[model samples]
Each structure stands twice: as structure tokens, then as C-alpha cells.
Target chain A: MSEFQNPKARKRGLVIQEMPGEMLVYDTETNKAHCLNDSAAFVWASCDGVNTISDIVREFEANSKGTVTEDFVWLAIDQLSSKGLLEAKVEPKFKGKSRRDVLKTIGLVSVAALPIIASLAAPQSALAATSCNCSSNSDCALQAGMCTTQMCDNRGMTPSFTCVA
Target chain B: MTSLQYGQNFISFGVAIRFESTNARLLQKAVKTANKALIGNLKPTQKPPEHTFVFGRNKELGTFVEHNGSIVAENEIERGVFKYFDSYLRVRIGEYCPDRVFVHSGAVGINGKALLIPGNSFSGKSTLVLELVKLGAEYFSDEFAILDKHGRVHPYARPINMRTTDGKYRPYTVDVSDKADLKKRKPLPVGAVLFTSYKANAPFRPKRLSPAEGIMTIAPYTLPILVNPAYSIQVLHEVMNGALIVKSKRTHAPRFGEKLLQYLAKVM
Candidate 1:
């Protein structure tokens, strides 16, 4: 296993919406919205550049009323880094370990096995917003430092083909 | 800022437009059509509106503008006027409503709370909502669910926007007060969230969703989440408390509506 280090959340252009047990994070920089479950949210919020892997696992155990292993924190950190939610990339400690080895090593419940982050690309406005029904690609909004490819593809529904990107 | 007054007032989404113009007949037609398209047949009150804006027609240019008191559009007055009106009403509601999070979803009252169905265009939201309404559920809205900070839902009543078989869109309004079949209801807390759509030959199979899953499913349809992410997240989170969320695929609405309500009653 690699040495553990504190992680930090990215600070710019990030909007977070919290539900009862999950967080919806909209990263304007990437033009993507991510849904982090309670476990993942807790891990992300706890990343203060101070909490080590062992510290996070203890915090999870205290609040979740369940046991967790350091591997769980590592799994979450892996996802956060991949999604650009972290300030820096985190190297997975179990790089050489297979899925079976990791599961056996952690010995956590199914729910605590790992964190899951679901995401989707959302338009700047509603699908029915006038901007979405653009006349051409020039009219489509720019995202991630690039112009979104816009085309008409509604199969002649009503006003013919409505623009989509 | 030119100010003209003719003592005519029209209100929608708590925003008022005091009509002021020499073209009184045209002003009346514009108000009526705009009200029909944006708001239901709500009674105009003597109490002052929350926000007031002046509306006037430019007889010379054959155009009109409200709120900003500028020539926002010129020519094609009929279409331009209502389009601008719709946009203004939407913005006004979002700005004025402090506690409500405006979500782009169809909602109906079931079990003294709301059943919100979230989806975008071509997702069969309207068709499913119509079915729920036909099955004796109180209609909240076909387009938006005005969810309060406490998570209760208020009515944003408007005509149902339905597409005909030929793919032509049309608005159909239901007179709840007069309709004997439809039940009358007030704003209620959210009891359930259904993430569903019509699928050909897809059996009425439903999978329950966690609160996290529910938030993600509805996130795309919640308008306020996009506008004020931090505040919206908290509001929607609280709004979802004690609500049953289901992700389901069904072959039909009328048949599935019965089963769905039964499921909600048992769970909620």
C-alpha cells in the first residue's frame, strides 16, 4: 500500500446541492453534474487536507453505525480524483491487488464496499429553453472551453427538428 | 422611463402588469391570452400585487414591452407579446418565491401530499400526468411543482400542454371547481416521487429508490437547483423527506396509475 496523504476539494466553479443523504455537485468547469451518495459525500466533505485515510474511516464508523476500512476511503478518493473533484490526483494504494483481493482485504459489508458517484452532462438551461432550439451550432452555448455540437434531431416533431447538443 | 396609466391590471405568478395604453381592446386581448397560456383562471384581487410593472403598446412600432419599460421586441406584436410574457412570469416566480423551489415536473395530489413525476420533453410527463388527473387525482400542475422550503408543494396551476398524435402541441385546461369528476385539493406536502416514462410492452415493474437516488433522478428537472445550487439542494433535500421515490417502467398510464397510487398509499 502507498503512503496516505490528506486530500482537498476543488474550490472553483463548483455548486453543491444537498438532499437528505446525497449531494448533487455541478462543476461549471467541466459542465457536468455529479450525484454523490451519503458515503461519498461524507468522504468528499471530510477531505480538508488534514484527515488521513485512517481518520476518515474512523469518522465514517462513528457516524454510519457501521464498520468501514481504509480501503473504502481509498475507493472514494480514487473516484473523486478521477472526476476532478479533488485538488490533486490520488494514487490507488491497492494498485496491484485484484477485485477479489481488495474485497477480501477490506471485509466490509456490501453497502460499505465502495463509494458510488453517478453523473450526467446537463445543459446550462432547460431542454425546452429557447437556446436549446437553436438555429445553428453558433447559437449553441460553449462548454468546457469548446462549442457544443448542435444539431436538429427530434424526428420532425411539431416545429420540425429542434436543435440538440 | 415613460409611464402611461389606463387603470387596467393583470396578475400571474404574483407579478402584475398594469396595462396602460390607448389601444384598450388590444391590451385586453393580450392580457387574456397571456393569462390563459401562463396562468389559469385565477381571480384578480384588489390587494396590490407583490411586484408591479407597467405594460404599454408602441402604436407607432406595433410592439409592446413590460417590466423593463423598453422596446424589447418590435413587429409581430401578438406572438412577441405572449412569448415575452411567459418568460417574464417564469423569472418573476423564481425571483419572488423565497421558500419555493420551482421544479420542472408534473405533480398531482395523492394521499394528502404530492406525487411528482419528473422528466423533460418527449419523456411522456404530460401523458402520465393526464392519466393521473383522469384517475381522480387533484391536479397541481402539468409543468412545475412549486415545492416549499419545508418540502410541501404548492399549486402552479396551468393548462396541460399535450401533444396530439400528429405531434402538434395544444393546451387543455381543467376547471377543477366545476369538474365533478376531479377532486378539489389544496397545496400539500410531497408524499412520493415517481421517475417513470411510457415504454411499449414494458410491464409495470417498479424499483424503489433511496433518497440519494431520488435526488439524482429529479435533479435534472429541478429548475431552482440550476439557479441557486446551494439553497436548492437544501430545499429539495428537506422536500424529499418522508416521500417515497420509485423508478418504474410501465406500458400504460391508466392501468399503471391505479397500481401506482395503491403502492404509494401503502408506502406513504
Candidate 2:
């Protein structure tokens, strides 16, 4: 990662919803959903394959979001890149440093809120959350090899479902 | 191949389905079972069914249920066949329904607004919903919260299948149809969404979720999310915009339901 290098946000295969002080981005390719707070959303919006790290910091200040250090902008970039929101993957700048140390250093001098993105993977099959009764391995709700069911045995009573590896 | 002796076409949530059976008696039983599976969600349709389910008996397979030519469930007991088909049909409809999104949630209405508690089976949602109904909140559903394109919740008021306190935790249905004013039931605007699971003796300290965070939390339980990501996200945005979303760990249903109503009465 370089301060002079320009970054672009990935726009393809994503569904985004902009809400008050937050943005929701769903990656259709990976089935991952990310919730970006205002600070991170601003940084992502500014990444148009044109703005350098220094330029993003200046834009942040111009928008009256308060003064932010270049390190703070890097923190958001590292997260966005790792989450596959960037057009090109950037090597993590804080690879060897603990997140708490980085946050502490950024929080000490930056007046703006710390950038945070919360993410969750949408299940490939919603049936994974619900119960399923299967007569064969193929009918199991979960991914292959993780779930296998026993032969259906009711014997004139309620059905019993058994899972075996 | 066994000749299909009886069949019926039905529409549920805009998804057309046909149920066929080699035995006339089994077909009649299946019709009754399908009605219970969706509650008031199903109706007869003239359109060709997009999915077809067949029920039949054979010497080798005994009794079986098939969907689109694949065997879904097989058992010697007739009761088990219908039980498995009931669950299968619900999941199928939830997965492919074109017009509505089905979330595995328990919904109730208070002051004409719906409160949705989203969770999978055995999460104690049914117990909480029953308690809420006992406390005079109008019961919407104990299984699913069917959301239309506008994000309004329509009632899927089926009998609450409450798990027994015995060690087995077997489910038993408690019919509240007498209490559910189905004649007057209509779609209710979402007032709030609560994400909670039973944790014995855990204090009910709910933290508010941002709209974006709320959508992320509910995405896994949303059935059509993977099928139609754009439409699902659009509807979820509509839901979180006007609704209060919160998450917490709850204690027993009776005690927590009482406290929850008080908390909602103040906040919502």
C-alpha cells in the first residue's frame, strides 16, 4: 500500500443501500453483506480511482467531518480492501500490528470517528437454519459432506431424524 | 409408473404448485395438510404449477413424497410422510416464492403495528409469541413473517407449535384461532424487529441496531435473499427504515414477554 497510489471502489456484483449515517453493501459474488459507518462510507465514496490518500484526508476535512490523520484514512482503506470492496486488493499496511494498537494511535490524534465495517456472510441455502428430514445424503439441507441423515424409520409413529458423519 | 389418481393446483404467495398422489385418499389428506402448512396463505389457481409434489406408496419404498421427480421423504408410516412434506413445502415456497419474502420469525401486533422476532426453529420464538398473545397482543404468526413488496407484514397465523417442558422437547400445537381475529386481520406496518434467543437467566438488555446493521443481521433468516438479492435488499431497506431493530439475550418467555412489552410500549 502506498500513500500516492490511487484506489477504486468495486461496483460490479454488489447491491448497495444508502441509509442515514450508514451504508449497506451486499456482494452478490461472495454472498457477503457489509455495514459501513459514516466515516468509512465517506472514504469509500471518495475512492474513485483518482483520489490519493492525502487527497481523501483533505476531502474529509473539506466536508466538515473534522480533522483526520492520513493513518485514519489508511485504516479505512485497509478494511475496505480486505473486505473485497476495492477494485484491486492492497497489501495490509498494518499486517504485523495489533488492531487495538492501530486504533489507539489513530484515536489519539484524529477528531473524526474511527472507521468501522461490520460484515456477515449470507447462508448459501436458507434451509441451513431450519430442520430437515432426509432419506438420503443428497437431501440434507447443508453443504456437501457436512450433513448426512439416516434412513427414515417411523414404525407407525412420529418420524425420528438422525445425523451421521 | 403409477397413474396419478388425484391432484390439485394451488397458489401461495404468487408461487404456483400442484399436489398429486397415486392414491385418492392420500391426495385428500395432502390437501388438508397443505392448508395447515401455509395457514391462510394457499388458494386454488388455474395457472400451471411451477413445482409439482407427488405422494404415493410402493411395496419397496412403502410411502413417499417426491418434488419435481426427486424423492424428498420416504417412510412406512403415513403420518411421517405428511409431516415431512409439510416442512418441505414451507421451505420450498420460502425459497422460490416470487412476490413475498418469508422470514423464519414470530410476529405479533400491538397498537396496530407488527413486532417481528426473527429466529430459526427451537429458538423459543413460539413460546414468546404465545406469551405475547396471552398478554393481549394480536398474534400474527409463530412460524413466519410474510412480508409483501411494500414491507407490510401479512398474518400467517398458524397454531403455535410449543415445545413441551419434558426432556424430549417434543412440539405440540396450541390452536389460538379463537383468539386470532382472522376476519379483521390485515397487513400491519412493521413497528420493530427484535433479535433474541433464549439464554437462561440472561438479563434482557437490548441494544439498538443501525439500519444497515439490521439488514445484515436479518439476511441469513430471509429466505429469498439468495434467490433475488436486489429485491430482498430493497424490501429489507424498506423494513429497517421505519422499524426499530434491537438484539438481546432473554430469559424465560413469560417473564421476558412481559418486560419486552413494557420496553416496546415506551420506545415504539
Candidate 3:
């Protein structure tokens, strides 16, 4: 089980929440909601402290079977920026998750790990781990933003849960 | 440059109208009454007075004008409007500002959220709108509404501009009892362009329209449909971006206005 922690990357002006099948982005200026599809969702999910734009591109490229490119990632970022989504944060690259490291490691990762990471990066699963399920859903006897279903040992991962019924 | 003062508040404008001819003189009472509205409560923002001159202009404003062998009063029809230069519109509480700049026959001091209705005659444009006032909709303006460059349509709560049985609009005449500026014209961007069709018995029908089609439908509502293609495109682009355009119709005027109001309640 892997932990999905997004570093300070989303942007200053938006509120991003993970839903069941889609990721919802709320733009405060227009008071509107914009959603991301599977591909866009992949890029948005990879906007974590451990990933760079190159990492996002590589992951998306693998998902699309190498049909996308770096230029497409840049263009997508531009489109998101225009839609008031991805804002310029001026964040320096993390010591371990640098661009070159991403290019090299991403080149080595097995295509087998793509779907696994995608499932782990499930927008709803990420949200289930973060939000206060105990407060909103009375049945949620669990803490917020963590997999509410079951508790694990030192795995640091949320285990699958089942309903009482 | 005479300034209009309402009660104790004085709002000045760069453009001023002076009654110089018999037709204009006829509208003096209406202008003065309209000025009372300007002075009473409708506050438009005011700008510092500026001065400029147009090269070819004739006759002062608010008077009957003789053009091309036909007598058209400024109150009757908008003519030579191309001659205006450096005009500005402002809407604030007590400052003398233009209610709308793109207007042909405008009066300052009027106030309200301008509800624009632009459509060809017999489109039930005036009938449904007048009925709206009867059904508790505030009267913004009659025909034309004023729009800014950014396409913000001002809301001027003037009297309803309905064609009376005698064929004229109803102006607010309580305080002054003057001859009304019955047929003044302005090219207002429709706040809700109901591209309507009058029916004989069907219930009022209101539908949402794409912004593009609304613009195309609203252009003709502006006074003076000249031969200029650019004119249609210009007005069309602005109205499309700035306001909510819909397709509304009713069997009769009463149900039409009520349903139109009901639809606006959902959107606005």
C-alpha cells in the first residue's frame, strides 16, 4: 500500500477534491466547477511533491502508450493556467525528485507499475484518506483523508474496508 | 452648461441637452420630470466634464428635426447621432452622469437595473415587456438600453416604453404633468433577449438560447437598421458576451410576461 501525499503544487486559488470517478476542481473566481478526465486526472495526480512536470509527462505518456509528448504537457499546463487551475508557485525541485532523476527513473519503470500506481492514485481513494468521514458521514467512524475502511500495522497504508451489512 | 440638481444633490454631465425648438420645448416638462428622477435617487457615477466638438452637426437636442424633407424630432426618432463625440455615461447615487452612453434618446437621473428587450416589431417585444411591469417587473427602459465598451448594460428604471392604444409610451408624468417624451429611442443591449414569437393560444414558452444566436436576434432591436454590416456584427458581439439571451413566447401578452418573469427568476 502506498501513501499519496501532494506537496504544495495544486495552486493558491483553487480547491481540488477527489470524487468517486472524477477529480473536481472548483474555481473561486467564476464560482464554477471544472473536472478532469482520466488523462488529465493522471497529470493532476502526479502534481505531488515527489513528481515534476517531466514525471507527469512520462506517466501520462506511459498511460497513452507513448502517444503524448512534453509539448502536449506544456500545452495542457497552459490551458489549465488559462482556466485558473494550475498557478505558478515558483517551487524549487525537491532534492530527491529532481527532473533528471524523473527522466532516468521513469525510463526504467515497468509498464506493469502504471496501473498499480493509477489505482493507488485513485482520486476518490486519495480524498477518502483526507476528508473527515467521521464528521460528514455518520457511518464514517474513521479519521479524515485516510483510507477509512480498515486499519493497518506499520504499513502506513489504508486497508480495504467493508460495510457493516 | 446648466447642471441638474435633484433635491439637494447635484450631478453634472459632460453632455447637456437644451430645449431650443417647438418639439424640444414640448419635451421640456418630460425632461424636467426626468431630471427629478435623476435628482431623486437614481445615482450614476459622474466624471469630470470634458469638452470636444463635432465637425458636422445640426440642431440642439430634444427638438423636432427636419432631415431629408421629413420632420423627425429627437424625441420622435434618433438622427445625426453619428455627430456626437466624447460622450460618457456614469451611474452612481447623486453624481450627474449619463445613465447610458450608447443611447439615442436618453435622460439622466433615471435609476434601476436596466432590463433590455430587443426584437423586431410584432415579436411581442413591447407587449410582454409591458405586461412584465404589470406583473411586478421594474421598468428599466423602453426600447434601447445603453452599453459600455466592456458590454455592461446599465439598468435605468425608467417608465415602461409601451405602445399605448393611442400609439405612444407611458412616461412618468405624476410630478410635472408635462408632455411626455413619448417616442424617444435608445439602442440598449438586451439584458434578456427573448427571441420571441407571438402565439394565439399556447402557454408562454421560454427556452435558453446560445449566446451567438441571441446576438444575431438582438441587433435589429437597436434603432436605425442601416446598411452597415459592421453595425450588426458590432452589436451582436457585445450582446452575446454581456447578457443572457433566451427564446421566449406566449399565446397572449399576459401569460407571456408572467412566464418570462418566471424564467428570469430561474436564471438571474
Candidate 4:
């Protein structure tokens, strides 16, 4: 792990919307949207560039979030770092351990829900979701009037156009 | 090539556009088509157009439609020209509309609250919306759920396009305004957002989604998401704030619609 004990959340190039118990973070840089559950949101909010992992554990417990260990906090940091939500990437503390194994260890002791971040890549172009009645690449080229290479996706019950790089 | 002779400017949802044509007859047809596409949202505007569309016929390209001086669609048949223009105009307005967020959704008002089913074309949203309307729900739209800044849903009640089940998926339009009393439709507070698609023999078991998760689920169907991400996310956040979001797979629209209304009544 890096020597920097205080982890900061990345605020640049991100649009955040806080909900009842969850938070939606859109990374404009990567065009990815992440839904951070309550536990993860708490940990992310606590990462103010001054709180160490141990400090976050105490804060998480004091907030009536159930007793959590450093391992639990590390788990959230690992995910946040990997998703580019953290300002500085932190090396995985559980280096060689499988995620299932790590979660199993964390799940046994923690009473609160484990921190989870669900993510999805936003569409490259909004038109991809629109209906296009085309059966071939040439048809999409003519219909959409774009010069880029595109293919007709017929796997679904209906056909649509998907841009190909 | 025939020089464009007639042109008209229209403003809809805060976006201004101009349509021109070489033939006067075709220009009127284009105006009529644009009005239908926006469900009468277009209004005459003297302001300069932000985007200009030209429809004309020539020996080289035959019948063609051009947007911003680029040929978007060209065909030998004039009928294809209007069809292409209708689709193109809807997408362009949806992308650039400054005051509203257009989601590819089917919306219906039930008990004065709106239920939005967000999906793309051929996702069976139109079919489900038709079934709901038949069950006495007020129809809002089958193509778009126009959302205001406060996340209230306004009616975009165009004619529902139903796909024929003859394996060709040809669509036929159905106007439910007479039966649904769409003239009385008003903006409604969103009560629920259902994300589901038709699957063969699939049972309707719904999974509740968190607000953030709900935004992610509907992001792809949001028209201005790429054009204005901040505004789109803000509006979507308002939508998810007070609405129930669920995902499920269903077998048929009629049966599923009945069950869904019942389930919503008990839960919502």
C-alpha cells in the first residue's frame, strides 16, 4: 500500500447526485456512472484527505453503521480506487486474496451491509439506443448518414445500429 | 438540382429549426410531418434557425433530405424522404431541446400519478403502454416522456405504433385519445419507473433498484445525456427521488399490465 494514509475523493470531472441513502457519481472523464451504496458513500465521504483508514472505521461505527474493521474500510477503498473515484490510487491491501475470500472474511464480522459500488458505461452515442430498421452495415451508413463503420445488431428481437471502431 | 424555393421556421421545446424544400407541395408535407412528430409542439418562429433542413429532388440524388448542408437520407422514392425527415427531426429536437429532457419512454397516468416505462423502440414499451391505456390508465406518450425541470411528466401523446406479430414487425398506428380522454391529460408527478422487457415465458418478478441504480438503468435512454450530462443527471435525479424503480421480465403485455397495475396499487 502507498504511504499516504489520507485518501481523497476525486471531485474533478465528476458529477455527483446524492439520494436518500445512495449516491450517483458520473465520471465524465471515462463516461462511466457508479451507484455507491450507503456504506460505500459513507466511506467515500469520510475520505477528506485527513482521515486515515483507522479514523474512517471509528467514524463509520460512531454513525451507527455497525462495527467495522480496517479490512472493511480497505475493501471500500480498494473499490473506490479501482473505479477512479479516489484522487490517488491505493495499492490493494489484500494483494493475492480472491474477492470472494476477502468479502467472506469481511461479511462474517460486519453487521452492516458491505460497501458496494455498481457501475455502468454510458453509451458512446445516444442514437445507439434508438431504433434503426437496418439489416446490414451499409444500411446503417445510409440511414444514419454517418461515415463511421457501424454494424446492424440483430441479436436482439429487434435490430439496431452499433458503432464499430 | 432544384433550388430550394419555400422555407419555414419552427420552434419546439426551445429549439429552433428551419425546413425548406424545392417543391411547395413537399414543403407543406414536411411542415405537417414535423408537427405530427412533435405532437403539435412546433410553433412559428421568426428567429434565425439553429439547424436548417432542406428537402429537394434532383437528377443526381433523386429525392433527398439534407441537414446542415449534409445529405442525411436520399432515395428514389419521395415517400422515404418524408419518413427519414420525421425520424431525423425527432432525434435532433430531442438532443438539442433546452427546456425539457426527453426520455425514450412510454408514460401513463394512473390515479393522477405517472408511471414511466423507459426503453428504446422494439422493447415492447409501446405495447405495454397500449395495454395499460386499455386498462383505463391515461396515456402520456409511447415515444417520449417529456420531463420538466421538476421531473414532472408532460403528455407527448402521439399515436401508439403497434407492431404486427407476423414476424416482419410492421407497425400500425393506434390513436387512443378518443377512448383515453387525452385532451384532459396534464403533467403528472412520477410515481414509479418500471424497467422491463418482453421475454418468452418469463415470470414478472421485480427487483427494486436504488435511486442511483435507477439513474444508471435509464441513462442510455435519455436523449440529451450526451449533449448535456449535468442537466440530464439533475433531471433524472429528481425523477428517481420520489419514484419507485423496478426491473422485471414479463411474458405478455396484457397479462403483465394487469398484474403490474395491481402490484403498484398495493405497493405504491
Give the Cα lDDT of each candidate. 0.65, 0.83, 0.39, 0.83
Poorest 10 consecutive residues of model 3 chain B by lDDT? B82-91
TM-score top scorer: 2
- Candidate 4 CAPRI grade: acceptable
RMSD after CA superposition, every candidate: 7.3, 5.2, 24.6, 5.0
Q: A1-165, model 3: which lDDT tens digit per residue? A: 111222224555454544333454544344334555444556656656666566776777666545554544443443344454544433232234655554455445423222111111111121122122233323333422232232211111134221111
Residue A90 Cα positional deviation in candidate 3, in Å, after optimal superposition: 56
Return the DockQ of model 2: 0.35
Instruction: Answer with 2 or 4, whichever has the higher TM-score.
Output: 2
Identify the runs in model 3 with alpha carbons over 4 angstroms from their true place.
A1-165, B1-64, B67-115, B120-124, B156-158, B161-191, B224-236
| Ten residues in sequence with the least summed lDDT for candidate 1 chain A | A142-151
DockQ of each: 0.20, 0.35, 0.01, 0.30
Q: Any runs in candidate 1 off by more than 4 Å, and if so which?
A: A1-4, A10-33, A57-71, A87-111, A120-122, A126-165, B1-30, B37-77, B80-88, B166-184
**Each candidate structure's count of clashing pairs:** 1, 0, 19, 0
Candidate 4 lDDT tens digits, B54-170: 878889977877888888766566665566567668877988999799999999999989999998776889999999999999889998999999999998888898867766455
What lDDT does candidate 3 reach at residue B259? 63
Off by over 4 Å in 4: A1-4, A94-96, A132-135, A138-165, B1-5, B21-26, B57-62, B69-71
Better of 3 and 4 by TM-score: 4
Docking class of 2: acceptable
